[model samples]
Target: MAPLMLFVVSMAQFIDIMNGSSMTVALVDISKALGFDSYSTQWIISAYVVTFGGFLLLSGRIGDMYGHRKVFLLGQIWFGLWSLVISFSTTPAMFCITRALQGIGASMSVPTALGLITTTFPAGPKRTRALSVFGGFGAAGAVVGLLLAGAFISSVGWEWIFRFSSIFSFLLFVVGYVAIPVIPAKAVTQKIDVAGAMTATSSMICIIYYISTGSASGWASVQTLPVLIAGLVLLAAFFWIETRLVKNPIMPFRIWRLRNFSSAFVAILFLQGQFQGFTYFTTLIFQNVMGYTSMQTALAFLAHSLFAVVTFTILGKVLPKYRLKPFILTGFGFRCVAALMFAFVQKSTSYWTLPFLGLLVHVIGLGTSVLPAQITALKDAQNEDQGVVGALYSTGMQLGAPLGLVIVTLISENSVDVKMGETPVEEVMKSYRNGLFGVVALGVLGAVITAFMMPNTVPAPPAAASAPTTAPVENSTDVATVATVGAAAAVVDLELDEALAEAAEKMEMV
Candidate 1:
């Protein structure tokens, strides 16, 4: 594969993964800079997340209708534009809105880029190399983002983070414009399910809005309650519409018939919620209560980031030799233990204690989780739904972050007295400890879901992906090199699921 195509397709994933973590260390800076109160400030992260989650399904459908390359280029351009605007943002509203727009661009770029990769590479060793490159980068982007963001936020400025992203995005835009070939759309015509998509997106936005600001609004204010109820109504309507009204839905009901698939989806959804919630608040704990600088907080997280790389590197080698069950279960079990360990952070806690130990263990879990989960989520999915399932898997991962952050925000800092400046660090620490206990519970639940729900054996890669090639060889990028240089899967993202029941006619027919 040409380096330019690899860069174009994988860059967006890198940016998205990087953005998610890059902001965490800088979040305290953002809050103080913009004069945002705790409740309103949550939007800095949740705004991007709400849009990222809401817009994912619609964006993929857009790719199917328009040319994937065109949509991808447009998306990258949009992201570059938004990143530039974000660096110049002078107010909280400006920052939040621009970040949301950035998420929209990201939503547009990712699936289309993957589609471009698939269409660009023939379905043999070439496609495998492309996918291995693609997935490897997708997994690694978050840690790279964290490292750079941490180093630069203090050395340069948090604003430099966006400036760098803007520059990289534009460079990719130019390169992609010149190099990314236009691929013709397939003959399959799929409906966009406009109504269901809108309802679902709107419902999620409203619900997240309610969770975020509802705490500061007194949780049941007349204005907030109505929005919350309306979100529920819209959510109910979305299900009804998808199940009965739409000729073809954004999420096909038939896909849920695979028990493993369904179980994987729920497990991922919960795991992500826990993971992001943990990251957001833990970032706060390290910087705020622990009195660490942005640089220090970033450095503290360095262990998790480094170990994630090592674990993935080992998995790439060992996965082919091992049944996924041992790796998958052990990874999830480590995650559960890590969460439980993190729940023990204290006001006087040493960095090397539960905080460091737990983070180290958690990264190992993340490394093991991503590949098997990706393999599992797409396990029995037909080739036609590959794009959609991949999109769904990505969505399942992206959507969890904001909701988890919201729940943590509410539980840890919701008291009106705290806003009134009557709260002490001791009392605040009490709330933080309690809130983290809930996080530990979520992690345990996710592990439980996987242990009992996902298949106990390794699933074979899909036939289109794994079958031997008799087709004439084309010179390709060295996959072993790519695997050796494999990337990181975030504790906060890339949560895929495990395998399902035997591929019988009932589920495969779709």
Candidate 2:
């Protein structure tokens, strides 16, 4: 039953993540069919990203309060319905609007899916294994999305992408309603932090919008700079509200105090940024420079998906035996090496050579790093806090995509002197290589943070033998002594109750 339920949940994650990357190959086809200009075409992707990233925190909290399973079902129905609408879209505006709504649906499901896993499985090896499988499905989804998009575009049409998604989403919703256990919401009486939710969501939307569009629109232009500053201001105000005013904040600040939490957060951010940047540029180089068709480009990434699947499966069995630090550092090391290799790609280079090898190495690094980072972040969370904690981790990933693209786009643009018209292949190659070096820099930064900040090993629970036992109470003095001991025991128990609640309260109040 657990395995079956995991499949349903993991499949949901896979489908949601697939939408993020599937558009990479399908975008050109979509642009042609919908008559979208270059600038407006970008909105097809950005609309989804903006809504998805912006709504994640609020959705996660909603799941925690309203029952994860219920929210999960609703999200699936919403996603499926919008996917159907997208397939029928005749205009660019309709497609982009549906895509944005689809993102909101995804935002609702992803964090809750994670919340369900963390709360369903007890912490330790069982939960670790579950997470590894869940993460593996998510990682595979990106590459599979590309592969399927190419196949669909080459054969039927791009509309089939959304049509297929709609079918799968509806199937998952039906299967999930039966397979997933109905866990009750947390019993806390506090209302949702409406003000905090607004500020946080608005800040994310503004920041991500700026990051996604700033390169196309000048960074200091009226459109980008003001939004960036407004986002920062809203972010600051959100923190102030969370720290000072909100009795129950949408995002509690205490989760940051968990062991290795901050380090894992930063590391995953870098990892995701590099991943998005590398894949985006690689796809462009394949089609624009090397002149591969969409199908050919998808086939080129087959190695990456295959290797990631294998590595993740193996890691699920072996990850419990080792410490996280070594895997994290080694993963980053592989990423740096792969990006460095990609930096030298030439127009005449064979797909079987540098690009192929780089794909293999990059996926290996991703498998090695991402799963452990997820475990590190979620392992210490209290069951009640799992939804929001997972949301924070996922939000880092969502933001990283646009942030990574922005940085690499700037690097590539600045590196070459190509004109607005058709440019030579050699100049384009040079630009891509320079952009890849930026990815290498990101990998190096992740490695440095992992080396210095992440602890060598996860803290283990105290052995049962070390637990204090109470003797029979005999008299008044002994009863008093027992009371004192009981009070101490209760404190210890609270600390051991995932160590997130009372500690978070103390830290926030201070």
Q: Give per-model TM-scores.
A: 0.79, 0.89
Error of 2 at 441 (Å): 0.8
Clashes of each: 2, 0
Clashing pairs in 1: 139-488, 140-488
Each prediction's whole-model lDDT (CA): 0.69, 0.85
lDDT of 2 by residue, 1-510 (tens): 668778988999899878778899999899999999977888889889889899999999887767778888999999999998999999999998989999999998899999888767656666777888998998889899999999999999999899888999999999998998765344444589999999999999999889888877879999889999999999999999999998788987878988677789888888998998899889988888888999999999888888888888888777766788788888888887888877788888898898999998988888889999998888776656788988889999988777877887789889897653488888888888888888888888879977888888753343322444333222235557767987998899877986777788899999
| lDDT tens per residue, model 1, 214-233 | 65676789858998899999
Consecutive 10-residue window with the lowest summed lDDT within model 1: 469-478
In model 2, the runs with Cα more than 4 Å from the true position are 185-189, 419-421, 459-510
What lDDT score is found at residue 301 in candidate 2? 89
